[model samples]
Target: MYEASDLKKGIKIELEGEPYIITDFEFSKPGKGQAIYRVRMKNLLTGYSIDKSYRSNDKFQPANVSNLKLQYSYFDGTNYVFMDPETFENYSVNADLMEDKKDYLMENMEVDGTLYNEMVIDVTLPSFVEMKVMRSDPGVKGDTATNATKPATMETGLEIKVPLFVNEGDVIRIDTRTGEYLARVSTK
Candidate 1:
């Protein structure tokens, strides 16, 4: 259980039998009223967000959430599969839950899997990943005079802008959060 005073960003709590992670939190003491806690939370199961307020005396149940290190297995036509490296247990997550993240997934990649009530709820990839450019247009001479970029398709099929010097077959580091090219990595 958690007191309203314990509410803060990143804290997980249970409400109405569902788990929620606090995304934002603020405290206020009205001129004539008791202290209130304003919280914005995201439902772990549904990915829905809500804003609610509570008094300092309010209490909340702690959410049951766990993190596991899993390795990317393969994507069946319908679902993405992950495996626990130690136990060799397999878990499947729906495509809808992957969304844009599907673009960054690579076979054998290690990621953090968030579990709620023993069910996989979410997966977190590494902050950066290196991928080979499958296709890219050659940069024109003198294009380097300014900060120029060209579109490159990664082996995963994710398209990103790379510096003018980048070419097809080159490996590049990408920032997963922003979907931006970080730097070119030598294949050697």
Candidate 2:
């Protein structure tokens, strides 16, 4: 259980039997009213967000959430499959649930799966990933007049802008959180 005073960003709590993670929190004590906690939370199961307010005396149940280390197995047309490295148990998540995350998933890649009530709700990838550029146009000579960039397709099929000097068959580091190019690693 958690008191209103305990509510803060990243704290998980149970509401109506559903798990929610606080994404934003603000406490306000007006000149004459009771202290109120304004919070914005995301539903772990549905990927929905809501804003709520509570008084200082309110209490909430703690959500049952756990993180499991799983490895990406494969994507079956309609769903993405993951397997527990140790137990070899398979978990399939709907493709809709993965959204843009599917762009960064790589076979055999290890990731953290967030479970709510023993059911997988979300997956977290590494902050940075190394990917090979599958296609990129050659940069024109003297194009270094500024910080120029060109579109490159990654092996995963994710398209991103890379510096002008980047070419096809090059390996580069990418920041997964922002889907941005970091630096060139090697040329193949």
Candidate 3:
């Protein structure tokens, strides 16, 4: 349980049977009355944001959210399946929640899965991943301008800018957060 004074950004709480994370928080005390807490929260399941206010005596229940290390199994037409490596329990997350993160998913890759009320709500990829360049154009011989980058397609079907020196069939490191090329790993 949490009191109004305990509200802060990043805190998760339950309201009306739904879990929400506090994205913003503000506290104010009137000259004569009690203090009020203003907060903006984002729904853990639907990715929706809402604002609400509470008085000093208000209390809230903590959200039942847990993050588990799960292995990516496969995605059927409707859901993305993940499995607990130790227990072998399977979790199915809806496609809408996956969004663009699906591009970074690889078979047997480990990811952080957020579960709320015993249901999977979100999936997160690692910070960096190694991928192969599936296609790229030849770089011009004398075009060595500073910060020059060329377009390259990765085997995962994600297109990103790579240094001009990168060529097809090369394995390279990529930053998952920004979808940018980091460095070359090896040439095929």
Q: What is the C-alpha lDDT of each candidate?
A: 0.93, 0.92, 0.92
TM-score of each: 0.88, 0.85, 0.92
| Lowest summed lDDT window (length 10), candidate 2 | 139-148
RMSD versus native structure for model 1: 2.1
What is the per-residue lDDT of model 2 for residues 67-140, given as tens digits with 9 covering 90 to 100?
99999999999889999999999999888878879999999999999988767789999999999999998988
In candidate 3, the residue pairs with backbone N, CA or C atoms under 3 Å apart (3 or more residues apart, or in different chains) clash, namely none
lDDT of 3 by residue, 1-188 (tens): 99989989999999999999999999988898788899999998788999999998899999999899999999998999999998999999898887778887889999999999889988899999999999999888899797899999988788999999999999999999998889999998
Candidate 2's displacement at residue 95, Å, is 0.9
Q: Which candidate has the top score in lDDT?
A: 1
What TM-score does prediction 3 earn? 0.92
Better of 1 and 2 by TM-score: 1
Model 2 spans > 4 angstroms off:
24-38, 55-57
